[model samples]
Target chain A: MDREFRNNKPDMFTVELFDATSDLAESLAHSEVIMRFTNSNQVLINDQDAQRLVQEANELHQKLYAKDASRDFMRENFPRYRELQNQIASNPVLQEQSEAQEMAINFLREVNQEISQLLGIDFGSLTRRPDATC
Target chain B: MDNLTLNEPEVASKSRVMEVARRFTETLAETAQYRALEETYQAFRQDGEAQAAYTALQTKQQTLRMVTMLNAVGEEDRLALKQLEDQFYGLKSVQNYIQAQETLISMCQEIGDILSDAVGLNFGLACRVGGCCG
Candidate 1:
């Protein structure tokens, strides 16, 4: 039996589903939390001082985790990495971005909860790709 | 930057976000994939033979749980389990149910990808219960 329901051309129902998904995405993107997140992200990106600190921390993080890095090397660089992380965390732009991101995530979770409630399944878990690490 | 607050009047209210989410869920319910999944599941539930086969398989598996875990199942027990599995899977209702589920999952994965792209986050991963760390 040919059981495949999908084809190269989607049916009207599939088109409607996609459109609704787009509308939801648009609403979420325009929501205050997401808007704040976007704005804060922009601010963080435009801040040269924050970017430099982030870059420096990232480079140190890579070195610390490198296969050839000795225990002594790790010990020497770990404190500096922590200090750089502290500086980045203290930056107002970065702080706002972090908060905004957290808010956006919470909002999305709430939305997912609503969807799951109506559908009688965990939408996120069902939709998650098989290869996804998480 | 001043202390960021989510209480601003300019932000989209939670009610509006929920409304859009409801719309998305309603649209998803209308999709062919979802409809097929629902119908097949109902059919599978109503299929006495398929349900009996599944119950038999599960009972056999439970009976052999300890032996199976230790890889010490006797040949007769193993063959019995295999036969039960085959019987359960051979049912048309079971096959239809599985196919419908796969199609629905594929549709959901596409939607997840779209939402992830639009929201600048892995929608499925973020909304997952317990999340990546958990």
Candidate 2:
């Protein structure tokens, strides 16, 4: 009862879902919008927009990959947590279990909501970019 | 008495029967596996070691291909193992489950068929933009 759900989080699960959602966004941005990769030089898909999708996508991909490393901490410790949760499932003192479980649920909800928002924007207007031949 | 007897087209009769059988059997199997996968995801989401084992599963979900969506069914199963702490119905919403799965098999496969002769890779992960997306 004394434990705060948000204090200890399941950051790994959040990162995993985030990474997956970002992948879809990256692909769409590449083909439909940014179009291709560039380094120092910027290329245009046609006349107006810069074809730097590959670079943008790579940046996003790198961010996702970097954040993904946090999962290692969760991956390393989740088993012990489960073991404790199972052992204490029937116990009248659920303060600790409740705390841990709540933290996880909240973390997942945050990730789901965040990824949903990201996809909503990327998929909505960006996906509908006017069709043009490059 | 013979007035009730209707002559059926040769292809029509066989096709109708086959369709009916496929629907019944596929629905049953899909339901069972879907439920099992849901449980597995729940279990895994709550457990970390299982989550690590499922890295391949996670990668598969995000991979672009015509069938990536279809391939994501397996992701649901893997998620069950990762050890999330959320409170959810042991049973997922039937409509959501069906829609997701249906999209995987139908949309993914259809997209794959439309894009290439092959059936795997769903839509093509990372999609490089090395060649024409269309």
Candidate 3:
């Protein structure tokens, strides 16, 4: 919108740029990685047992750091917590969800690497918040 | 599966994706914030008084590098250095450049957020240089 830039004037570059960005956004939205991540996340969120386990873990974690906390108390409860986590992790649906989530992340990282290569700048880093260490 | 070719079809479309990325970058460069940053940066560079003040500050800082590191610099020298820095920062072009650069960074963060959410990973985090920004 600034009148100062020569490249900002009406031109083929502008049209191409707009079309490219639109196409990219649409493509990204329709990406299988995105769809899989969304579905897997929903499934994870809807798992009642998983939610209950998470809540229990949080409660136990809070109690571990309470004023009356003890290493022995942590040792006693931590194993049960780990057992529950292992059980939840072993669920076929959760396993698929976890794999899908990881797949999606890898896919995105590859995509970002490609973009960074094209721009000769780390597109992902450029877009990161200032306060973010990584 | 071990090599992470989760989807061959998606990988094949990498070129189109890069084209989209290039277009997006072009559009971003054309934005008011980017334009303002460039303009202000040029102005800052061309500003004789600001440049002189900055050069003087840098020279003084270099000269007092050891003393400052050891916290042995006198209060008078420290205050003088601080005053020089204040004068350099007080320039209109310098202030504008800093503000514009921050605005551009914010814009980049927003765009990165969208990409990260779409891909289900922190894209910005992955692209950070040395896992941090200066």
Candidate 4:
């Protein structure tokens, strides 16, 4: 028999199950924490200064890993890199984005933990990719 | 920033969202694949022969740790390890257990993808199920 027939022999069961999932999804979409995170992240992503700072950081990181990079060059640019890092860290939008993102992640973690506790197994672990290290 | 719409009328309470999560978990447990996986896992756990094969392989690996780490495992030891692995894999019970597990994992991954799409974060990644490496 096909999987659907096995899992959903009773149509009402499938409907109720999906309805619950959709309800949870809808609530998640309307969450204040998630909304704040999404909006703040978008603002940070759109900010020119923030974008430049990120690009500068990436370039500095790449240079640090470059085969031909000299110790002197690193020593020379390290201070500037630190300054840029501090600037990024000090940006209010970035900071709020970070906080909101953490809150959103925590929210999901709490939800998953609740489900796992109820189900007697780690739901997230069960849902992980087959090749995942865990 | 706009006040969150979550605080508006028709908002879902935390308890309600958790209820939905519980329902979803119950639905997942009722699936044929998940039931099969649980049954096969129980069988694997109860199978004395399979357990012995697994324990023996683990013991052999532990005893050969030094040789294996040094990449100097003797031909005889290598052959012995391969034989043990083959013997373990050749068990019908072990094979069924493994297949059942794979099927269940696949189904879970699909459901996780749906949850991730709805929640705007990779569900497994957000849960940190295995580790942060992925």
Candidate 1 wrongly placed segments (more than 4 Å): A1-13, A65-68, B1-11, B60-81
Candidate 4 lDDT over A90-109, as tens digits, reads 98877887788778778878
Tell me how candidate 3 scores on lDDT.
0.68
Model 1 residue A92 CA deviation (Å) reads: 2.2
Model 2, B1-134: lDDT tens per residue?
45445431112232332333233223323343334445554565665544444454455445534354555445654565333312122224433444444433432222222221111111232121332321
Backbone clashes counted, model 2: 27
Ranking by DockQ: 1, 4, 3, 2
Query: Candidate 3's error at B67, in angstroms?
Result: 10
DockQ for candidate 2, C-alpha atoms: 0.02
Q: What is the lDDT of residue A41 in candidate 4?
A: 74
The lowest-lDDT stretch of 10 consecutive residues in candidate 3 chain A is A1-10
Question: What tens digits encode model 4's per-residue C-alpha lDDT throughout B1-134?
Answer: 24666445344556766777887888878877778888888898899999999898899999899999999999999999999999888887799899997877776776665666656677778888335622
| Candidate 1, residue B9: lDDT | 32
lDDT of each: 0.81, 0.33, 0.68, 0.74
Q: Is candidate 1 or candidate 2 better by lDDT?
A: 1
lDDT score for residue A35 of model 2:
22
Q: What's every prediction's RMSD, in angstroms?
A: 7.1, 27.7, 8.3, 5.7
Model 3: per-residue lDDT, tens digit, B8-98?
Answer: 3242254556566666766776777767887898899999998998899899999899998998999999999999999988988889889
Which pairs clash (backbone N, Cα, C closer than 3 Å) in model 4?
none
Question: Candidate 3: lDDT of B75?
Answer: 92
Model 4 residue-pair collision total: 0
Which of 3 and 4 is ahead in TM-score? 4
